[model samples]
Target: MDAGAAVLTALCGAESFSAAMATRPWARSPHFFVHYVPVENHQTVLTSPAHTALSTKLSTELPTDSSLESLGVQKLGMVVPKRHARRAVTRVLLRRQIRAAMAQHRCELLPGIWVVRLRAPVDRQAFVSASSESLRIAVKAEVATLLGDVLRRCRSTRHAAQAHAQPAFQQPSTVLSAP
Candidate 1:
């Protein structure tokens, strides 16, 4: 893999994802756990459950850059008990689907991390009967919707901040020197 990909893999690795989530901001879905961490130059997205028990302290650091282009998405899945090998395979498939969705909607994102976690009780039958294609489509649609919402909010807030930061201009007064 290339450097960017390698770096991503290392940063968002299963163990690291769990560790980061312990201290970062996160969102959730019925079958997912999501964590986000904004960093300089790039954002880190971590998805994990196996290392959920791990903990980390939150940092107050802000990213150096503030654009939507430096964002990334990490998709993670958990291996369900009893399914053994099938559990592993199913989770990999799920990750691939989520990645595809992220690729399609990446442009709408801002400079931040996005993590997705899929949770559930599982059995051998669940993996064997799962429809990966359908899952991919659903995830992509949701991702697109989320990106739009986030971008909209960011723009509005940015405008408000700029308005508040600038001082209002005063008109110059002209004095007449009539004798």
Candidate 2:
């Protein structure tokens, strides 16, 4: 799926958020962190201590990109904690930059549940304004770098998976051209 759709299409339940974060973060920047649980690992991760205790109805609620759903899609969630960004404007700005960065990168991201969290607050004294053009540009550049790192990691793994999927040697059929 396209990055735009991946950003907009799904809402993960609290249970899913907990399970996803249960895994160590896949990537981190100075101010942002990304956590990912690949679709293939969902069975083990989702059924971790939290989900195992949930009732059947609760289990049915899942992100669209989960293994049980359309596994090829990507589900994304963003968290900008109040403790980190005291102003509501700051939280929204962080989320906007994240979405914009994800969309800016054109590569096909690995299928998974993805979450980006704001890990630190910018120095208020440095920017002075809650929403400043300088802050936006800085955030945008940092987020783009963060996503770039993820794509590089995904590319290597994806290539390896593709290599293993296709046989190294195979018989080829030949056709003669008419003279």
Clashes of each: 5, 0
Residues 1-179, candidate 2, lDDT per residue (tens digit)?
A: 55455533353677667778777888899998889888787555545555455446555575333445555666677888898888888778888888767755534678777888888877788877778999898899899889888898888888999899997987797999999
Model 2 error, position 5 (Å): 8.5
Kindly list the per-residue Cα lDDT of model 1 for residues 23-97, writing each as its tens digit.
533444444454544443233332233323343523343433322233343222232233332455555655665
Give the candidate number with the greatest lDDT: 2
- Candidate 1 total steric clashes: 5
Cand. 2 Cα-lDDT = 0.75
The parts of candidate 2 lying over 4 Å away from their true place are: 1-8, 43-67, 170-179
Report the poorest 10 consecutive residues by lDDT, candidate 2: 2-11
